[model samples]
Structures are given as C-alpha cells and as structure tokens.
Target: MSASDNKIVNQENKNSADIITWREYEALRNEMRREFRTNDDELKSTVDEIKQTLDATNVTVTGLSDQMTDIQRNIADMRLAIENLTVLQQQQQEDDDDPELEDDAHNARGAPRGHRPRGWVPLGRNGRGQDEEDGLGKPKFSIPKFEGGADVEEYLTWELKIEKLWSLHPHYSEDRKIKLASSEFDGYALRWWDSLVRNLDEDGAQPIRTWRAMKEAMTSRFVPTNYMRNIFDKLTLLRQGVKTVDEYYMEMEMLMQRGRVRESLEMTMQRFLNGLKYDVKGIVRHYTYTNMNQLLHHAREAESQLAEEAKVKGRATGAGRFTPRSFYSAGAFDALHSLLYSA
Candidate 1:
C-alpha cells in the first residue's frame, strides 16, 4: 500500500470516530435535560404536598385555639359560681349567730330598729301595728300581748304563755328571748319595762341578759308582798261546806298553786283530807292511800256513795217528788183550791 492511501484511510477513520463521539455527546445532553425536567416535576409535586400540609396544620391550630378559649370561659364561670356560693354561706352563718333583733333584708332575722318583729306583739312604742310576717317573708307564730295587772294569777297565766312560746320555738338566744318577752308588753307592762331599762342604764348596772333576771324583776314589781300571806290564810281556812268533792278539791289546789306552797306529800295529803266535809273526811281518813291523788279518789268515791244514799232515802220517802203546794201558806192554799174548783 502507498503511504498516501494509508493517510487517507486514517483521516476517514478519525472523521468517523469524531462523528460517533458527537452523536454520543448529543444523546447524553438529551438524557441529562430529561432527567432535570423529571427532577423539577417531582420537586414541584413535593412543594404542592407541603403547601397542603401547611394549610391543614393552620386549620388544626385554629380549632385548638377556639377549644382553649371555650375552656377558659368555662373555668371563669365556675370561679364565679364558687364565689357566689361562699358569700351565701357566710350570710347564713351571720344570721344564726346574732342575738339581738336587728333589722335585716328579710323579716325572719329580726324587727326594725326598736320594734318587735313579725308574729310577736310589737312594743308599739313607735306606733306601728302588728306585722304578720317576719323579716324573712315567713309567717311568724302569734304571741299574746301582756299588759301589766295587779292580779298574781293573771300574771302567772301570762308568764306561762310566754314560757310556752319559748318551748314551741326554741332557737332563740338568751338576749333574744328576753327581748321577745319584753316586746309583748303593753300599757302598764310596757311602761314598767321601759322604766326598768332606763333605771338600769342610769345606774350603770349590767343589763338584764337572762330570762330569770327579767322574771325576778317582774315579780317584784307586779306581785304584792302580802299576796302569798293572803292566799295561805284562805287555804288554811278553806272548807268543803256544801260544795261537791271535785269543787272543794279544785279550790284547795288553786290556793296552793297561787301561794307557791311547798310541803311534804304526807302533809299535803292530810291537809286536803282535812278540808273535806265530815262524812267524806271520815271515810277518806280510814282508806289506805299513799298519795294525794289516791286520797282524793277515795274521798270522791265516798261523796258519790253518800249522794246516792241520800237520793235513795229521798225517793223511798217520796220527798224527791214533793210539789210546791205542799209548802204553800194557808191563804195561798185557799186561793189555789178556789181557782181549781172554778176551772
């Protein structure tokens, strides 16, 4: 082969190699572009998913915020309720502790200044009429007024009524009990209480805080010194006379109570027996009795038996059926005889 032919072949070979390398480079560039486009598309898809996740997170955060706000409001309302309940309990405690009748919002607690509350007879010093309801809008139990009187029995009855009032409604404090009792006073009784209070205040003496003290003061003022002596004298001189056993017993019992007598059961029984009529006392003395009740029972039975015997005797003699004409005078008898004949 000639050197020139060889050179031409080498050149052709080089050219062919060059062309193959160029084609391979172009293919590689195209592959790289396609890969880049695919990567870009995948990145864009990831970005869209991230944006959707962010939007969902925002919605969740908003919902959680609203729930937190509601929880806070509920907590606030619970706190308010607790505060109100505490206040109510405190108020109730105050009402129960106070002793004096002071004015409050409700009528049940007390009366207005210097006046009696509902259901109680007011002092009427302020010229107010009786009230039906107490401070708390509840009806009060009616208590009778106590006007001072000279009769010891009347005062005792009034005092007994006052005691009964306390027993029925026992929640009163010591001071309140005294105040309530005084509130029922009217006329002379009211004046007496006012004077007592004023005198004590002026003398710088301790106020009457107890019912016992008030009762003592009242007894001293209303009851005469010789009242008990008079009652005792009447009791000592008592006799059954023409009265029945029950009537005699009642009179003796009243005298004892009025004089506040205290004696042994035996002595009391004997005293009661001694007061009975001769026949009744004779029978009762012979009976076996341990107490006054037994003695009285025996006495009453004896009296009843005697009465029955008398009634039988009168019937047997026709004395129970006697007419007025039997006792008429001679002149009266003639008038009746003439009138009957004429008729």
Candidate 2:
C-alpha cells in the first residue's frame, strides 16, 4: 500500500483504457469502410442496370418510330387507293345514269322487269312468224344477193344490203334460205342447230365480212384516189381570175375553212395573193399587212384608187386598164398618158 504502488496501478489502468478505446475505434473504422464498399458496389450495380435499361429503351423507341413511319405510309397509300376507287365508281355511276345514244326503240320498249325482258320473247308471244321458236318476222326487206369477191363498189353495195337485212330482222336461222351471225365461225352467230360438218367454213359473205374490216378495206381501196382527185380539181379549177378583191378573198377564205388548201395560213394567203387579178394584189402587198383583215382592207382601198385613176385616165385618153365603170386598166392608161404627155 505505498504511494509508488498506487501510481503504478493507476498507470496500468490508463494503459488498459487507452488500449480498449483504440480497439473500439479501429473496429468502428473497419465497419464503416466495409459499409462504404457495400454502398459503392450497390450504386455501381444500379448504374449498370440503368445503362442497360436505357440502351433497351433506345432500341424499343427506334423500332416504334420506324413502325409508326411505315404505318403512316401504308395509311397514305390506302387513302389514295380509296380516293381513286371512289372517283372511278362515281364516273361509272354517272356514265350508267347517262342515256345511251340509240334509236327511240330503246325507250319505247319500256324498262326491263328483270335482268331481261319478262315472259316469253315478243316475236314468239305474238306467234307472228312461220315458226314461233325463231325470232324471225315477215321479211319486209330482201337480200340483193352476192357471189362475193368483187370491186369496192360491188362489195360496198353488197355489204350495205347485208347491213339492211340484219337491221330489219332480229334473227335468221342458218339454212340454204338464210344465214345468221356466229362466233364459232369466222364471222358471227349460228342461230340454228349444230353443223353436220365440224370445220365447215361458214362463208357469211367472204372477201369482206365484219363491218369494220369491210369499211377499212373499202376506205383504203376507194378513198385515197378520191381524196387526191378532189385536191387536184380544186387547185386546177379554183382561181381569183377577174373576181373582186373581197370576192376573191372570200372564195379563198371559204376554201381555207373547208380544209381544201391543207397548208399554213401564211402559205394559204400567199396562194390567194398569187391567184388574185394582179392589180389588187400588188397594191395590197405594197402596204403593211400582216393578216387577212389588214390585207383585205388595203386591197379594197388600192382597188378603189385604181378604179378612180382608171376613170381619170379614160376621160383624158381613149383606152386604159380594168375598171367597173368602164373596161379600163391603169397599165394601159399609164402607157397612153405617157405617150400623150411626152408629145
């Protein structure tokens, strides 16, 4: 129990307390570091997950945008198709509503009850013909007959007769007496029973059969020469000659309108000027005239002046050029005037 022993004990006790505090502080620091590490790892995992989710979201958004664009395009295409179909339907309906250009028989017959004329066929119902089964009526018109394979005139006449016969009657049975149109044949329909022969060439009227084909052949054969002949005749015969300026212009103008000249307006005007009686043409051309109206106006003025000058010259001398009042021309008057004046 001395003072020194007490001091030593106190020192040991302080040392033990310091050692305990150091241990506790070290443990707390270690635990805090572990917790910080755990928090950092958790934060890193969360960040990584968020990054993956963002990448996936970007991909999904891009796909959706592309899909939306494609959907928009498809919608646009559908709208256009619908609009076109609507317009086409409307036009078809309009055309359906419009009356057909035909004989009044279409209206006089009245509206159809069903898809077709109701009941038995009219020609059968009346029992008018020799056979009710056949649609043939009394033959009001006769076929003028044809041997076929002829010139344009003969062929044309024969074709017209066939047309007339078909137009007059609704049907004709194929016999020696009469023949009908057929699709199985080269031409039209066969109203009667089957042919005994399979490949019998139904000569419905050969060399020219179908109306279109016949017309085409006829036009090619006959029209070209006739067209040329007309042009030649017009050119040879049509002349201004002694006609007045207005008369000549009007004649040429009429011919021009009728497409007789088949040339440009300038060329036509040139032809008309060439054909004119020289005196009117010369003075009119001397003036500035770009078109027909101006040309006609100037020509009339010049013609009047020529007539007046001719009248003056005729009074002074005995002879002259062309004039309405007298048979005097400016050219002859000029010569006579020069002869007398020179003397």
Candidate 3:
C-alpha cells in the first residue's frame, strides 16, 4: 500500500509543474509581440516626419532656383540696355568728331550755309533749278521759261509788261515800284547791268526790299568775305555794266587788302550767280553791251598790266585782274551772246 501512494503523488506533482511552465511561456510570447508592434509604429511615424521635411526642403530649393532665374534675366536685360546706350553714345561722339557729319546734320536740320533756304531758290546749269521736293518726289515749283529774244529792247519790253502787270496787283504799289526801279539802276551804278536786268526780271520794283529779304533769308548760308565780294562785283555788273563791276571788284579787293571789308557781306551775288551758273542754264547771260565797250577795253588793259605785274613779281595776280574763276570767260561771253542772239 505505501509504494502505490508514493508513485501517484510524484506523478501529480510533475504534471502540475509542466502545466505552470507552459502558461508562463504563453504570457511572455504575447508581451514580446505587443512590444514589437509598438516599436514598428514609432519607426513608421519618424520616417513619415522625415519624408515631410525632405519635401519641404525640395520645395524651398525649387523656389530659390526660380528666383535666381528671374534675377539672372533681369541682370541680362540691364546689361543689354547698358550696351545699347554705350553704342549710341559712342556713335554720337564719333559724329561730333567729323565735320562732314556735322554739316550733313545741319543741312538735314534745314539750317542754311549762309542764308535761309526759303528766300533763295537754288538754280542749276541749263536753266534748271532745284526746288524743295514734296513727299511725292515732285518739285515744289516748276521752272518758268525766261528765255526770250536776245534783243535788249525785247527784254525791256517784256520787263515793262511784267511791271505793268505787277502794277495791276493790289500788293504792288506804284511808289514802291518807282523807288525799286531807281534803286536797282542806282545800285547797279553802270557796273552790274546783267545783275540789274536779272534782278529786275525776278523782283522788278522790289529790289531793295526783296534783295534785303533774300539776304536775311541767306543768313545761314555764310560765305567767305572774298567770295562775298566776288558776288557783289558780279551782281553789280549784272545790274549796271562791266566798268562798274570792275570798279567795285577792285575796290573790294583793296578793302580786303586793307582788312576793311572783312566779314562785310555774309552772302554776295557772285556766290549766288556761281551757284546758279552751276545749277541753272540760261540764268546768266554774257553780252558785250555797247555802253560797256570802253570799260571793257580799259578792263582788258588793266588785266594785262596786272598779268605783267604778276609775271614780273613772280606771284599770283589779284583776283579782280585775273580771269574770273566762276564767270566772264571770253568764250563763255561769246557763247552767251550766241545763245541770246540765235533765232
């Protein structure tokens, strides 16, 4: 009986111990699973936060890049503008250094050389004149037919007809006409016959006022003093005769030598006549007036003496005694007469 009881008790104790150990192992496994789940959740949260921070940093970098691009564009534009301004300034400086450019700019701006562009009409050789061209390339005024018979009487008759026609106009006063005629004749003083005649044809009884206006207009067209004197001499001859022309020309030369006539006239008839001769044909005519025959002879003698003096002195002759640079060649005079006298 004692051996059976001992065996049963020992078996029961062993069975109880095994049951307790199994229970403890199950509890520990459950706790470890819970702890692993908590740790995984925390790691996921930290990873999410880091990802958000990275995204924000990327956006900031992108924005900074865009701002840099805009700044670069602005800098480039400023550079281009500065370069253009620099080029323009350089070109202006270059133009300032050039006299021809200055002249061209002045002409383009409608500033005259000595006189205003309005009062004096530019004439060409062959009786052609230049007028201001309109935008359509047509001249502002047409050239008038001024050539008539070569007879002085015929010219005078035409002039009288024009004078009479002018008289009919309300703007033309008889007193003014008489005064102008007298002034023209007197101004010519038997020297500037051709100039006188031409002026009469163009201006008639308004020589003083018209010529003065022309001169005023020509203020921008400044010419050399010697050139002015030559013009005055030429104009005097046109108005009067060669004798007066020579006298005036000589007087002007003397004045120039004495420095008395420096900058006397800003513009002169000779310059106008030269321009006309170069531009217009038939504007200036050469003829040996019977009244000027003696004067011409004396001028020839004086010219000869001047030439001889020049040869002896081994220097250039005075302009008055020398052949005219612009007009008054023997051949030119003969040609003019032929053209005038030709039927």
The prediction achieving the highest lDDT against the true structure is 1
lDDT of 3 by residue, 1-343 (tens): 5999999999999998777576788898999999999999999999999999999999999999999999998997797688656644543454356454346445544765566444343432322123211101122222222233333333334344444544553332333333333333322222443564477668734333332343332222222456546655644444223334356445544434333234423343332223222212131224222333443454445456555766877654444365554556557877788899996
lDDT of 2 by residue, 1-343 (tens): 9999999999999998776577889999999999999999999999999999999999999999999999998997797688656644543443334343122225435656543333322322332212323322234455464433324344445555566666664233222123332211221112211331232336422323234553454346434566546556676467777777888777766545333347776876677677766777778777886876776788789889999999998787765444644524436667777899999
TM-score of each: 0.51, 0.29, 0.27
The numbered model that scores best in TM-score is 1
Candidate 1, residue 287: lDDT: 86
Better of 1 and 2 by lDDT: 1
Question: In model 2, which runs have C-alpha deviations exceeding 4 angstroms?
Answer: 1-224, 236-238, 257-260, 316-343
lDDT scores in order: 0.75, 0.56, 0.47
Q: Which stretches of candidate 3 lie over 4 Å from their true place?
A: 1-23, 104-343
Give the C-alpha miss distance for residue 281 in model 1, angstroms: 1.1
Q: lDDT tens string, model 1, 1-343? A: 9999999999999998776577889999999999999999999999999999999999999999999999998997797688656644543444445333333324533555766455444322322222312212122566678889777777978777888877876654455567677777899999989998999989967678678899889888888879878888999999999998889889998888767789999888888888888888887777898987888889889998899999999788895565776757446778879999999
Question: Model 1: how far is 278 from its true place, Å?
Answer: 1.3
Looking at model 1, residue 223 earns an lDDT score of 80
